[model samples]
Target: MTRRLLASYLSLVLLALLALELPLGYVYARGELNRFTGAVDRDAVMLAELAEEIIDAHSTDMLPGLAADYAHRSGGRVVIVDRKGAVLADSGASAARGRNLSQEPDIASALRDRSATGTRRDAGTGAEEYYATMPAWSGTSVHGALRLSHPLGPVQRRVHEVWLALAIGGACVLAAAALTALALTRWITRPVHALERAAAQLADGRLAPAPVIDDGPPELRRLAATFTRTATRLHHLLQTQRSFASEASHQLKTPLTALRLRLENFEPYLDPRAHDSLDEAIGEVERLDRMIHGLLALARLENSATTPEPVDLDAVVADRAATWAPFAAEQQVHIAVAGQPAGPAVAVPGAVEQIIDNLLANALRAAPPGTSITLARRRTEHAAELHVIDQGHGMSATERERAFDRFWRAPGTHSDGSGLGLPIVRRLARAGGGDVTLQEAPGGGIDAVVRLQPAAPAEDRFHAGRPRAVARFAAHPARAPRTAGATAGARVPGGSDVRT
Candidate 1:
């Protein structure tokens, strides 16, 4: 940008210089030429007066000496021509005596009793010469003509010197303009660069002691001040929201626990008919407790802001699958793992585990007995994907769209789910620079997918010692071969299966 500005400035300066100096130079050259020619014309007229006296005396003896003296003094050529257009005397060897001068324009004009001045090329030397001619008269009767000739080289040399000076002056002016343009550009761009950096930091959640800029133009300074104010307000608002969520969860959990304990103690003393009602009340309290916990998790995930780091996704999956193995076996369902040797992926410290755990819980709650749930990992050039596939009833398009909304559950599904699981999973995944999505699984159920940033090649080698397991189930007995395929029942809410 600076270079472009400098070039534009120099170009304008050069154009202005050309517009002003070109005409002035032409006028100067013309004036100098006319001044030199006028002086030579006056000298020729005076010499004509002397030549006329000698011609009237009918003697040519003194004419040659006078002409030679004038030529030697003025560094020019002189010639005397008679009225009949024949050369009478010559001052230089180049001007021959008795030569017919009738065809020369200046001499012809002089013979007709008129003075003439002109510039023309010399035939012998091929050099430009200026000529001045006047008639020699004896009482109005023309006797002869006197002519003076001078070379034009000196006049042209003076004009060239003037133009050279103008060119040098123009170059100096353009150089100064370039320097000024560079300084101005730096002054304008410095504050812009500062603002860019400040914006980046603000986007990354660094809001305390907002960026300060006291340099540059007044408009930029005002903009910076406004940005600082906005950041402060945003920080204050976010802190208030987080505090409310944290306080609400803590305050509600205490009372809910006390209520559950009281109901459990009363169960022993109550009659059998009243015991059923008491158990229902206790179950409601437990569901409320789970909802509060989900809210707390959502709030924490939303508040976290940290840079992503490399994590062994395969190890995370294996660990989480192992943790859920006992529950799966109790329900008579098998959990299997299948994937390639995928490298580490970038995610928040523990974000990947939380995501996998939520997906497994959801799948387990939705899967029927004797059906298998598969956890698969796939790697691509730019990202890695983790999928949990279960064989159960899948959702329609509308349900998938609202699946990430807080406290939203599918119609006629289980009431045990707080509906915050998917939302929390989404929040955690996004905070770790990744995303979670739900789609229809092959054959019958839903596929929960999580995409994460791929780690660099250098980071991939750090997880080399970890074991890679494929198509394995933890603590499960081998099943007997079936004579024919058996299909599981359609998924229903609040049935024998757990809620995700």
Candidate 2:
């Protein structure tokens, strides 16, 4: 930006300089040449008067001799013509004396009248010359005319000098302009450089509280102050939101825990028919509990501190698979593992486990019994990939797109789920310098891949270990369902909120 501004400034300056210099130069040259020509003409007239005075006494053979002497002294050619316009004497060539005078109108006119003067060329060489014609009279009677001529070379020399000076001056002006432009560009770019660095630090989330200095131009300083205030406000707002979510989670968990315990105590007293009806109620409560747990997990993941240490992807998948083995076996589902030639790990611990758990749970619930679910880890030059594949019902393109959207359920499916599961998985994976995707599996199931930074020594376990259990179930029958028929308000049980 600074360079462009400077270039525009310099161009305008140069154009102004040229606009003033061109006409001024032309006028100066013209004035000088006119002054020089006037001087030459005056000198020629003075020499003619001197010749007339010197020859007046002798009056017979003296006119021709006087003209020759004038030419030799002035270093200019001289010619004498008779009153009839016939050439009487030439200073350099006496053989052309007494030539026709009618052809030279300027000379004939000068001899016929009193003093008459003009400039013209003789009928010989094309070289330019200045001429002055004067009558040579004896006792006020016109005898002949004297025409003096001189070359115009000196006038040409002065004009050439003027042109050279203007050219040199223009070059100096351009050089000065270039230097000024460079200095101005530096001045403007310095402050912008500082601002750019500050913005980069903010983007990296490493900026803490610091007062910004109001330095640089007025507008620039204002911009810097605005950025500082904006950052501060955003930081405060995020802190407030995190605190609110944590507080809300804590408040909601209390009654949920109490209700779960009461349900457990009531379950034993219920008959078979009541127990069967209560199971559905229990499932709904569990679903609501899972949603709350997901909200809390999302909050925790969002507030997690950055750790640069490399994490083992293979170990994370293997560990999660082992932990979920019993659950998968109860559902009669098989789990397997595969990967790239290079076994590498991602760069986050608990994040990888969370992502794996969400995918595995979704896959197990959707896949048919005895079907195999594959968990594979692979490493390329740039990234590491971990895949969780299951032979379950595959989703359409539209479903795949919104699969990770929070609280968005597929149409016509009755299984209880908190939509926050996939969204949390995706967020955690992305925060760990990785991404997650859902693709078509080999046997018409969903293939969920977790891609991350590939590097470092493979470990049998993650460094940062287990997370706290985030799920709970109802402990009593009446406390379990709380459906519209069961509760006083006729409200459904096991939703986001249970109204009294």
Give all TM-scores, in the order shown: 0.64, 0.56
Model 2, 1-500: lDDT tens per residue?
77787888789878987898889888998898677667656765675565455445435356567668877886667777656777656776778776876566667667766554545555576667777777767677766577777666666777788788888888798889888877877666656766777776666655655445555577777777888888777677777877877787778778777776777677889887787567666666666766776676667666555553466565566677887776576667888877654355544545665567667767765767788899877777777888889898878878877887878877776656667767876776677678888898776988887788766664333345543222211111112122222222221111121111
**Residue 230 CA error for candidate 1 (Å)?**
2.3
lDDT of 1 by residue, 31-125 (tens): 99889988898888889998999999988678888888989898778889899878888777635888898888888889899989888887778
Candidate 1 TM-score versus the reference: 0.64
Report every candidate's CA lDDT. Answer: 0.75, 0.66
Shift of residue 154 alpha carbon in model 1, Å: 9.6
Report each candidate's C-alpha RMSD, comma-separated, in the order given: 8.5, 10.4
**Candidate 1, position 74, lDDT:** 86
